[model samples]
Target: MSDIDLSEAVWWKSRQSAVNGNCVEVARLPGQKLAVRDSKDRSGPVLIFSGSEWAAFVAGVKGGDFDL
Candidate 1:
């Protein structure tokens, strides 16, 4: 993966996100990849993950895999 020009990236918040303001933004990059960052700090380091990887994480979340 090369450098990503996040400045042009359009981030989308999750639909399931509560109205409590605890939301994250995801940007679609080239080459079937995605960049995720905290909505509170857009300038923070992003956690880049592949589309498949993100899907798996979502599945895990829906399956109660990360329930504390």
Candidate 2:
């Protein structure tokens, strides 16, 4: 993932996110990178992910890979 302008990125919240109004959002940045940040903390730290890695993560989520 290369340098991205988080300031211009449009974040979309997770589908499983609840209505508690405290969920973070994910935005697809340039170079197929995934950017994440807390919705409640726009100025907070941002996490970046590569395209393939992000895709695999999404697939895992759909497959309940993190389910205990």
Candidate 3:
């Protein structure tokens, strides 16, 4: 949250990402958190999440919980 420093965060996109540059980048922050941003716009908005939150999201993804 407010305690995490993102200025020096090193963001990286997934190797699985396609070459079309249509993917998001992620950075591991301090205190078991993560920072996510759009790869197409580095200077755009960012989203932060706690460790548990990220885990749940990943689980949902793998379980197809977000599938429509």
Candidate 4:
């Protein structure tokens, strides 16, 4: 992730986020990569994923694979 340039990355949070601002922000980076960071800590560590990895995660989410 350090090899990627995020200086101009545009980040946005989901509309379903809590009004208190407890949410994560996602940014689409170059080369089909995605970056995620905590909204409360914009300068904190970020999680980066490949396009395929993101797609699988989203599919899992929609499939309720993450449900407790």
Cα TM-score per model = 0.82, 0.79, 0.89, 0.95
lDDT per residue (tens digit) for residues 1-68 in model 3: 56666789999998999898999999999878899999999988889999999999999999999999
* Residue-wise C-alpha lDDT for candidate 4, range 4-30, written one tens digit per residue: 988899999988999998999999999
Tens digit of per-residue lDDT, candidate 1, span 1-68: 44777888999997998787678899999878899988888887898899899999999999999999
- Per-residue lDDT tens digits for candidate 2, residues 1-68, read 34567778888997788887689789888778888888889888889999999889989989999999
- The order of the candidates by TM-score, greatest first, is 4, 3, 1, 2
Alpha-carbon RMSD of each model = 1.8, 2.1, 1.4, 0.7
Q: Please give the distance, in angstroms, between residue 36's alpha carbon in candidate 2 and its true position after superposition.
A: 0.9
In TM-score terms, candidate 3 sits at 0.89
Per-model lDDT: 0.87, 0.84, 0.92, 0.94
TM-score-superior candidate, 1 or 3: 3
Please identify model 3 stretches exceeding 4 Å from their true place: 1-3
C-alpha displacement of 68 in model 1, angstroms? 1.3
Lowest-sum lDDT 10-residue window in model 1: 1-10
Score candidate 2 by lDDT: 0.84
Candidate 2 Cα errors over 4 Å, as ranges: none
Best by TM-score: 4
lDDT of 1 at 55: 94
